[model samples]
Target chain A: MAVEPVKIKRGFQETESLKMLKESAVNVNLCYQCRKCSSGCPVADLTARDSVSDRTSAGPLDEKTGAGPDSVPEALRSGMARDSVPNSVPEALRSGMDLTPIQIIRAVRLGLEDLALNSKTIWLCTGCETCATRCPQDIDIAKVNSILRIMAYKRGIKPKLPNVAAFDRQFMANMKFFGRVYEMGLVNQLKLATRNFMQDMDLAGPMIFKGKIGFFPNFSGFLTMKKFLSRFKKARAGKN
Target chain B: MPEAIAYYPGCSLHSTAKEYDESLRAVFTKLGVELKEPEGWICCGASSAHSVDELLAAALPAQNLQLIEDMGAKEVAIPCAACFLRFKTSVYDMKQSKHLEGKVAETIGKKYGDTVTIRHPVEILEKMFANGAKNQIKKDLGKIKLACYYGCMLTRPPKVTQFDDCEDPQTMDRLLKQLGAETLVWSYKTDCCGASLALSEPDVVVKLSRDILADARACGAEAIVTACQLCQANLDTRQGQIAKKFNENFNLPILYFSQLVGLALGLEPGKLGFDKHLVDPKPLLRKYGLLL
Candidate 1:
């Protein structure tokens, strides 16, 4: 199969959001498509491209020579030890977000800020740091996703995964109001806002019985909390 | 006795994970380490704040660190993995970015010089009992099989949390071993439990946590021992729902490492807050003859 020549678009400038992500210390430009970050990602099961066939068929010798092998090496033909390679991208990835960590980084590097910011992968990311930890380039992909989320929120970009975004907003609001997470407040607000009332209702009775649910917010730290929040707002305002 | 270390339980200890707080205190006291919680400590801003506002996330935890400095404590111990990550990230940010330090100081209405060292209870217990806590062990848990789950925050993004190897951390495993519990080597030790999404996206939590539980079960672990309150809550509370959703029977009892440590230290099960867990660990404890 002959590969087609890809045309490179010229005179493209980096988006402000992309520059902001770079300034936040996420070296998106350093990702060399090694896909190590994607390979080892925990959620790669839900996010990475299904490149398993490509991986299994393209043996080490074929990959090194970039040619079809007539007589493949015995070691290479059998495919290197499976244990040495991370699990192949699972079938689950085909259903959810198509963009992997490397793909997200690639989008940012290519100045596709809108595509990166609006990606379902950004919202689904649990911030587990698996991508960041496994990134051979040491780029903090998790931090980049976080920054992209903030930018997406600031720009009023509607998240494809609204529940995830709603949860983040409700959680932050709870923190801002109580200077800590008020579980009841957060839950009630989230349920009302997202209309996800019956999702975890079964566990609530047991949780209450176990004394895990507090009836009211702890107002003891109100004063120091006020100071802390005010300063945080001032800093954010200054940044804006 | 060693000098008292400042303890910041974060919001979860005061609310949902009260058992974790009690068990941690009981275990530490038995180990002869005094814990002093600073007055009026707030939340660590958790996953929510960081996702929305980075500055708030830094400031919320910095305020607590400031309180530790105010108490003149040389070190502060955080039991919750998420809180530990927040504090560590705050200290890391303050050291790396003077701009962040100034903003944090401005927000907290106080200047913290980053003198107080942040320590996770696991790290402290690992160091304190490095020579084996056998002497402190009253009820041997040698018969109990446990899978130590580190979840996400305890050790992730090695630069932010520079405690152990990010991929396969062994701090919790080593701690469980000290308690004489048979710790199982599992693949999902550091996997995420869907965290805050536990509320917003229960299905996601169910899917992800179900995998962790199934993996532990596959390794022949009788119970899943977790260091994070969120991990414990998610894994314990969602098992039933997961069982129904996936048509699989998963009755795995998720426990805090502190609860197991308290048991080894001869603390009463009630005192350790065993009753608070959704998936009662008492049955598992009794099965292993660690409980009467």
Candidate 2:
């Protein structure tokens, strides 16, 4: 039996959020659930419960994938060779993060805003552009994830991954103040924001020993950065 | 023969990836390409600004692009892949949408004509080597096999970068082959290195980097070469963690392609910052007789 496509809500195009996404040029409707993006995405199935062998060897290939290569979905069969697709997602890495790249796009198209916004997939995205590059529809899924991240922030919906959210916030603050990234300050700020002082503390010894981490911040372009960032503040205030 | 091209090392070159800065300068100088850095170049708002405020991300790189224009250069070479992607995306976005360009100009207080072209060091080197620069190689790299890992940002999202083939980039491989190093055919060339999550969620990086390193080892590579600083750092600094977490022995030295180019050009290993690596590459270089 053929699975039916999910119906999009009426007046989706008239919504402000959809209009913003449309302006960004990401046409979610063009996606036909090809699964190419999920296949190539590094973080898509990191938290998958199935072991690599269980997923690659037994279940997906047999039960889900049907009999043989001919039984496979046409979209996947056309994109990747059968042998090359195995073991793409490794064994259990961490917990949570269920949605894949293809799933996230589907959620957005179906007007499931909260599901897409609060997904751990959006936070865990490395902005690697793998999904964007391989999409048959040419939808910039990575760009959509970035936009969703910003939207999540605007809505004050807590990020699924707090540490990743903290890191982005601190990184922006670092750029705003120093004009350039101050690794030392940024790390300290991230540590403070996340309150996970012990994490990655071991690497500090080697990093300092090799002079990889600069101890001080550079403020050479501080005034210029402050002046430049002020314009955004003014614009935001004007809009509000 | 060409006039000086603008060099934007980004923030990492000045700090965590200082060796990349040193070796890139050394190799480019050897290739007779003059690099002029724009004055007071700010951050391109790398993964952060874009993830938070789209306008801020576009504005940050616009300011730096304006500085490059002021330097009388039409092209800029960005070594860090993260910074390169941000700059290129900003330019691509502005060129595609005039509304974005107007908003960015308003935010930055300056209008950028989107005139500057962004090129990765690999692209620049590939062009140079093809154009009679191969004669500059002072020493052959012998038969040491390496995996040329492009990580994610280098040639991806072809619409923005418009560089080599995104699926299987061979520019770095072909460039290294010119100096006599064996480049392995690996499937993880454009795979993600978990760079954005390195600081936030290292367990993910460990798992991701482990697979990348394991694939390289499985393919009979003695070392890994790359053009991204974050990939180099994640692979180099996390090998022990990856080993401890996964019980796998992958001690491969992740090297910048520029460092190898400097070595092949007869520059001293110490001068190329080989000594600064967490996983020392000296023994591998010595075994291949590329270093004394």
Candidate 3:
């Protein structure tokens, strides 16, 4: 049975912070309901789709894909058989272009307020940039993903990953303060932050036997790092 | 400037991934980079414990983090994607609870100092490229086209493994650009390669592996280059099954970033450990004249 498509609601798009990010995004209206991007996508399951729920559904190359720098193989090289894949593959996909134009447009219209500060999708992107590299419009999909993330930070969507969000915040804070991520202090602080105190109960006998963990930050390395952090803090404060 | 780094080489490097370790040594030397290992290093509990028990995962790497503190290396660099994620998460978890350090001290007998940083090998390479090492790669595979695969850890859960841009990471692309290879724009870089899942649910692994290989071939990658050993193993070793299941031949070769680095460095195939791969890289090497 063909699965029915449903639209997922994103709550933060209209907010003030995302306004700037959306303005810079590319035109998403160019979508023609093509499923090549979906066909080419490796994590469609993560995004929950056979058909993209997003408004745009265009592939990267409908035209230039023939002779462009990013085009698929010429007549001869096309002879290389990838027998493992099925025969009915979509032409838009095999053309070698990512078709996430709507994302660029959406970012331009939304200003990334939602992406930066509210959406978990910002962190979910792995920078495969296949979307951009293969975009029919030659749009810079990867760069947009980056700028969206930077915007997320700008809008105070500071670190929300379940396992690593706390660490990133602390790492950034520690870096912001010390001008570097203090290895010892960071670990010690992190252990305290996570409160997984009991897991080490088993390791206590062995740790004491080995004397692996310790107290206090080492406070070594080049002293100039401290000065750098101070300046960085002041610079960021100026933005605030 | 590169921070003083505490380096972790998971068991694979000491054994199976010796090429990665050895190539890293030469690459680092060429790039003027130094990586230090903690004195009382322990296993990252591999990639399994992290998923099964987050706390245990944090504790294992925490124990090592504590050791890194003892060794006093400020920055941490991990090449293995699984280890990289494990360390990143452990420190991330430890940093959240505040009291866990003391708790860990009670259990592990040593206090973990916040003295080290964590990074992946690609980050180191990206840093070098951003700092102007692009001009150093004299040999250009200008004629070769590649599909660069990062698998899962590089781009997922962005807050912690902040090595590069996740949706379209440029680290490998930038490096490949320096080597004069055309990297395809594909969506599978951060997709799962089914790592240990191959043994547990190989059906899932095969499906995922097939998708990744198909994506690579679909984009016309003359070869697939990877940063993770498991990704290499899955994409290179499992093709026969992928072919059997999907009824197609995916004889594509998967190469390590180090092998490519060796190739660009004008090093011999023997020096690159090309022979060690279960699937021969010779067919692709022959095209590039790196093999007889």
Give the Cα error of residue A153 in candidate 2, in Å: 0.6
Give the candidate number with the greatest TM-score: 2
Cα deviation at A137, candidate 1, in Å, is 0.6
Of 1 and 2, the candidate ahead on TM-score is 2
Model 1 lDDT per residue over B79-115, tens place: 9888898888878877776776777777877777788
Error of 1 at A45 (Å): 3.2
- What would the TM-scores of all predictions be? 0.88, 0.89, 0.56
Off by over 4 Å in 2: A1-16, A47-96, A235-240, B1-3
The regions of model 3 sitting more than 4 angstroms off are A1-240, B1-5, B32-35
Q: What TM-score does chain B alone reach in each candidate, compared with the true chain B?
A: 0.96, 0.97, 0.90
| Models ranked on DockQ | 2, 1, 3
Per-residue alpha-carbon lDDT of candidate 2 for residues A107-161, written as tens digits (9 for 90 to 100): 8877877778877889988888899999988999989899999899989999988
Q: Which residue pairs overlap in candidate 1's backbone?
A: none
User: How accurately is candidate 1 docked according to DockQ?
Assistant: 0.35
The clash count for each model shown is 0, 0, 81
Error of 2 at B46 (Å): 0.5
